[model samples]
Every structure is written in C-alpha cells, then in structure tokens.
Target chain A: MSMTMTAIVLGMTVVTYIPRMLPFVLLKGKELPSFWQSILQNVPYATLGALIFPSILTFHEDPSFALIGAAAAFLIAFTGANIIITVLGSIGILTVLSLFL
Target chain B: METTAAAQSEFKDGLAAGTGIAIGYVPAAITYGLLAKSAGLTFIETMSLSIFVFAGAAQYIALSLITIGTGIFEIVLTTFILNIRHFLMSAALSEKTEEEPIWKKAAYSFGVTDETFSVAAMKSGSIHSSFMAGLILISYSSWVLGSGLGYVAGNAMPPVVQESMGIALYAMFIGLLVPSLKTSLKAVLLAATAAILNCIFTYSGALSSGWAIIISTLIASISVEMAGRAREKGGIE
Candidate 1:
C-alpha cells in the first residue's frame, strides 16, 4: 500500500483497538467498587439511548417517516422480538412508508 | 458429563444470538461501503478500513474527513474520541466474563462494538470466552463481508435508494435500545436524558460530536444511577 494509506490504516487500527484493549489489560480478574459497577452497568443503555432519540429525527430528511421508522422499531422491540426482527421490521415499515408517505 | 456438553452448546447459542447482530450489521456496513466508494475509496481502501478499524461510525467519519482532505492526525484523533466509549464497554464486560489470558481477552475485546456489547451485557450470568468468541466471530465476519459486498454493489444503486437506506442505521439503534427500555423505567429516563443532553451539546455547538456523546453517556448514566440509589435509600419508588 502507499505510505499514506498504510499510515491511515495503522493509525485507525491503533486508536480503535486501544479503547477496546485497555480495560481488559488493566482490570482483568478484578472487581470494581459497587458504585463504579453500577455506572458501568448503565453504560450500554445510556449510550444506545444517546445515539437514537432526536438524532433519529434528523437521520432522514423526512422526519415524519423517520418517526414511523422509530415507532416501528419501538413496537417490535417492546414485543421483545429478536434484534434482527426488530431492525428489519423497522426498515420494512419505513421502506413501505417511504413509498406511500 | 453435562459440563462439556453445556460449554459446547453455549458456543452454538452464542452463534445463534449473534445472527441478529450479523443481520443488522450488513445493511449498515453496506451503506458504509457505498459511502466510502462515493468518497473516492478504492475497494481495497474501503475493505481495509472495515477490516482494520472495524467500527462503523468511525469509518463513516473517516470517509468524511478523507473527502475534506483532513490530516491523518485530525482523523485519527476524531476516531479516538468517538470510540472512547468502548473503554466503558470493555470495563463493564470485564466484570461479567471469566478470567482468561490477556491475549484471549485482547482478541475478544477487539470485537466489542456497541451492538455486541449489548448482546453480551444482556446475557445472564458470567459469560464464557468461547461464547464471546462465537458471537464476535459471526458479527465480525458479517461486517467485513458486508463492507466488501457494498463496495462491489456501490455502482449500480440509484441516489434516492441510497439515501433511504440511511434510516436503517437509526432503526438498528432503536432496536438495540428499546428492548432495554421495556425492562426498566430507569433505562427509559437514562435514555431520554442522554438524548436530550446530546441534542443540546450538538445544537449549542458547545462540544464536538464525539465529546458530546461521551459526556452525555457519562453524565446521564452516573447521575441517574445516583438518583436511583438515593430513591432506594429513602424508600421511595
């Protein structure tokens, strides 16, 4: 590869992998304090939540259809459908809605 | 007798669980590939980004930076900031899985994306490395393969169709978040807080998008957790 491409790839790899690898190296077999653990436990839900919400409203140019997509996802997910089904169902609803609305 | 069999079966169960993630990843990764192609990345460039970086949002940002002729230092810095959340994910996961050699831990940690982390976190009890490997294996491969496929398929698609596919990304996030929301009121409040905080940060132009996400996640979760603890102490619902 060209030097620039190689540099970009290596840089990307390092930055991406470090966050993933650091905690494993530092905290292996160790239990965090309960307060910290409680914070850690809520990380996923909070992060995923931050990614969605108002952001979903702006993801599509048509905010109305995006709402339909979000609602579809919420309905399927509320039913406790598997992740694949919930996502696919939402996309399917939006694709159909995109056609009509 | 049951121990070996259970371990073996758990690996299969992990693979089964990962199928949903794999399916979700394909469309998003495909969109990434298509976008990368439009941004002037060759097939190898797009594929290598997916293979090496392996983070969807980071790669998309990379494409944007590349298009703008951003310097390597800035691009790398942005991705680092964006992916810093993985540290929290890995830290949380460290508590749930059995101890293994740091090398194996390193290997599995590489696959810890937002989606896979949620899958692993939602599983009951201590997670087996074998199960993690199985889950990571399928989800990782689907991402790689989907990127390649999307790069190959980039040319034939119409512009409008490509634009519509963007919604699939948000839909996937909703799918991941909504299930958790159903189980707890705290989760719902946590999500709303994070979302509102993120929106304010971005709208106010007070912080970069990466910083916004990291700060919102930290503040919303830690505060909500403390509030929950306070409520419990006071014997309030």
Candidate 2:
C-alpha cells in the first residue's frame, strides 16, 4: 500500500477507537442529556438508510437485478433472520440469478 | 483459587454467549473482504482495516470512499461521525463492568462493537473483565479471521462471482436497517428522510459520498428529533 493509503487506515483506526474507548475513560456514572442520547440512538438507522439506497440500485447494470436481490434480502430480513442469513440468502438468490443470466 | 474458578466460569459464559455473534459476523466480514479486494485495496491494507478499525460499517464506508478517492482527512472524519454511537455504548458498558484499572478498560473498550456492547450490556449483573475477554475473543476472531478468509478465498473465485459480491453489502445494510424500521415509526421516518436526502445529494452531484452520508444522517436524525418534539408539544407522542 502507498503511504497515503496506510495513513488513511491508521487514521481510521484512531478515529474509530476513540469513540469506543473515550467514554469508558472519561465518564463514570454521569449521563449525557436525553437530547444527545436521542440523536445517538437514531444515528445508526439513519446512516444505514443512507448507506443502502440509490447505491443499491446502482450496483448492477440492470437496476431491476439489484432491486430483486434487495427485495429478497428485505423479505428474509423482515422474517427476523440474522445479518449473516440475510446476506448469504440473498447472495444465494443472486448466484442462481447469475446462472440464468 | 476461588477467584480463578469464578473468572473461568465467567469467561466460559461469555464465550458461549458470544458464539451467536461470532457466527453472525462471518458472512459480513467475508463480504467486506471481497468488496475491499474489488475496490483495489491490497490484502494487507484490507486486513489492516479489519484488525485495527474493526467497526463493520466504518470499514465498509472506508472501502467505498477509498474507491472514490476521498482524502484521508475526510475518511477519518466520516469514520468519527459514523461511529459516534460507540460513545453511548461505551458509557453504558462502563457502568455495567466491575471497576478496573485504566489499562484493562482501554483494552476491552477497543473491542466494543455494536454487537458486543448489546450482549455485555444485557448480562444479569456487574460484569467481569474476564467475561468481556471471552466475548471479544470469540467475536473478534471471527471478524478478523473471517475477513482474511474472505480475501484469500476471493482470489480463487470466478471473476463474475467476484463482481457480484457488491450486492451483498447492500443486502446486509438492508438487513440491518429493516429490523429497526419494523420496530418504530421514528426509525422508518429517520431512514426514509436520510435516504431521500442522500439521493438528492448524490444524484445532483452536489456532494461527495462521504459528505453526502454525513450530511444526510445529521439532517435526517435532527429532523426526526424535531418532528418528535413537535409531536410531544402537540400532545401526540
């Protein structure tokens, strides 16, 4: 890897680690305000939504192909299967689809 | 001698509890490896990410951003924002764990992913460092080793299958998102709002993907909170 790329990885490690570590170091029994708590709680779902959409459509040349695979995933996920199953199950569907295509 | 037996039992319980989380991480970590490969990351670079960062969503975001040539600064900043929830989880965990010296908290705190946090947080009583070591050991090995397995295994795959690995990440994201969506109207609103904002930012060519995601998440989360406040003021919540 180039120096810049390595730097990015190192930087990422630091940034990711700080949030996971800082609170335990700094906070004992104190609590942040509920407003901040509320925002933090919602951030993951919000980020996941942004992460999934439009990009999911753009993954395949045929948007429908991506949508179909995504739909299978959604169906399995709604059934409350875990993350691994949802991913592997959809990949299975797409592999079968790939064979036909 | 007695403490040794108790700690051993706690560790064993942690290992058992972490087993399901370990199993769950495998496919996602494998997919992360494959995607990192296709994104032109070197194997070392890819594994460095899994080993060091170890946060699933942030590493995936890093891959996508790297492909788009985002700067190190932007990537780091995006990671900080995306992972801000760790603050909350770590705070919750600090209270749950038995008091320890600074070094041990630093060590185990580094292992607290969203998965590990929830499992540790929900245990019946005050937690031991030994118990966390077991939980993290099982889950951490699966994530790190599973990623390496994905990269090495990816090399032998047909090129077509390699290309198709892209969809799995999205599918996983959907899997992650929809459960929360099912549980709450706020989750649904937050996701929809963020998706719409991200689509606009991306499709209009107004922002890079890194900035787009950060802005969209902030706006959507704030908006959801505002709507929630409005409802409360109106006596609807």
> DockQ numbers for every candidate?
0.70, 0.53
Candidate 1 local lDDT, B142-185, one digit each (tens):
99999988888845655455555566556667766776677789
lDDT of 2 at A90: 83
Give residue A74's error in model 1 in angstroms.
0.9
C-alpha TM-scores of all predictions = 0.90, 0.67
Itemize residue pairs with steric clashes in candidate 1.
Answer: none
Docking class of 1: medium
lDDT of 1 at B25: 79
Stretches of candidate 1 off by over 4 Å are B1-4, B155-169
| Model 2 misplaced regions, further than 4 Å | A1-12, B1-50, B55-105, B108-143, B146-153, B159-164
Task: Quote fnat for model 1.
Answer: 0.75
Where does candidate 2 chain A have its weakest 10-residue lDDT segment? A36-45
Residue-level lDDT for B12 in candidate 1: 88
Candidate 2 structure quality by residue, lDDT tens digits, B7-43: 8999898897677567657766887988988999888
